[model samples]
Target: MDSWPHPQPLTNRLELVAVPRPVLTALVSGRAAAALPPPLVTPYLAGEECAGLWRMRSMQLSDKPGDAPWVTRFVVVPGVSGAVGAAGFHGAPDQVGMVEVGYRIAPEHRRNGYARQALEILLSVAGSSPDVRVVRASISPENHASRALIQQFAFAEVGEQWDDEDGLETLFEMVLRTQ
Candidate 1:
């Protein structure tokens, strides 16, 4: 990843803020600012659903040390400018080394290429990890932007699933090119 335009500094644009469950709980409780200090991007979303998911996962994945750092990350830009949104693995790889990915950019940051850049970084991480073989993203049919983003790589439509929160979702998957 040396070719990445942004320096490796933690505060650089397109930073990945690791939200371990404890950190996420702090963010939700307004204690993260003091506890974690600077450069750790917190959830900027007003949506309670996303916040709750972070809290719930904190307990669910508590025992899995590998998932704590990469499960959910805030996508920040402009060298500590702040979080524009988030992207991360839904969880650690399953028995077959498959993991799901999800990402969202803030409304104000749309069309800024932040989401794409963040997804690329995340994919790179997953691709290089020995534990991850496939990455999947579930998107609504109406989300043309999301569809286009995944298509930028070698991703393909593998299937669909029904979700209580999002209804029917089209599943896209990519076998990581590790070689």
Candidate 2:
């Protein structure tokens, strides 16, 4: 089990656990039902909607063995046995010290502070990294909740882009640290 990165001041209610390599493998191989026992894997994690994302992460791990810590993580409550959502950096900081973040809260888990907590955790991690100077979030224009969440952190609307999978996205960026 690769050590999952937990760059702290951790949130009181949420914990981000690294999705183990075994779990990713099972998810990408479509053998989660057989490879992962119940309660160890969530249906959302193994579902079709997230299959491509998981596969992409798997490819990242295989291509860059040291990037495990920067990949997908399960957002769980400390005392809770299951995850409420997923969040993490798109990858390690780029040459210019920018790291993009992505997150999702399960439908049933939405409307709570989980997404906010997850963003806080991601920003904490980014701020702790010397190589990370800018934290970026590409939210769809229709994702009002995410747009609002980043606004609370003072992220500037730097630009926008077209994602083949997610449609048009508004790009937001915040300095990782005041420095």
Candidate 3:
């Protein structure tokens, strides 16, 4: 358990909880089903996959240098109960000043404007850092909903990349206004 509290502040119907390695490990090992977080409803989008991704990100950050939070947070809706999904940065801003942001909301939580609000959290957090100048997001071309969510921001289609699972994905980039 982590003593430090670094939750993302939001002004909506949700809150962000830091998902530590232990919790993630349990989730992946199927132990969370018995003792999951109170706010997390049963069958939490099968977080096992996201936990695997989190482990990979953690390994990369540990093997490299610089400041990377390497933290995955759960989207908790207090009164409604249960975590909708997860969101966090890929890593700290690179030397070239680019940071990648990723997020996913459960199918049940979609169409409720949670994604847009969640994105506001990402943008605000990255913008608060002095070293971060640009935020990147890559989405599958067939994911019209995600594209629409990103369109709410000032992001532009910069390029594309091939993914093993998602195939060719369209990349969007946004330059943050740093003072």
**Candidate maximizing TM-score:** 2
Tens-digit lDDT track of model 2 for 1-179: 33233344453557677888888899999998789756546787778877999999999989998888887788876655567778899998888899999998878788888888888888888877899999999999999988989999969999999999889999999986644
Task: Give all candidates' CA lDDT scores.
Answer: 0.72, 0.82, 0.70
lDDT of 1 by residue, 39-148 (tens): 54544543554666666556657667666655777776765456678777888888888888888887777897887877777777787789888898999988999999
Model 3 lDDT on a 0 to 1 scale: 0.70
Clashes (N, CA, C under 3 Å) per candidate? 0, 0, 1
Q: Estimate each model's TM-score.
A: 0.78, 0.90, 0.82
Residues 1-179 of candidate 3: C-alpha lDDT, one tens digit per residue:
32112234345655556665556555666667676665563475445556566566556655763434534567666566677887777777778788887888888788987777667777777778888889999999999999999998999999999988659999999998553
Off by over 4 Å in 2: 1-11, 177-179
* Winner by lDDT: 2
* Model 3 weakest lDDT span, ten residues long: 1-10
Let me know the TM-score candidate 3 reaches against the reference structure.
Answer: 0.82
Error of 2 at 29 (Å): 1.2
Q: Better model by TM-score, 1 or 2?
A: 2
Sort all candidates by TM-score, best to worst: 2, 3, 1
The local distance difference test score of model 1 is 0.72
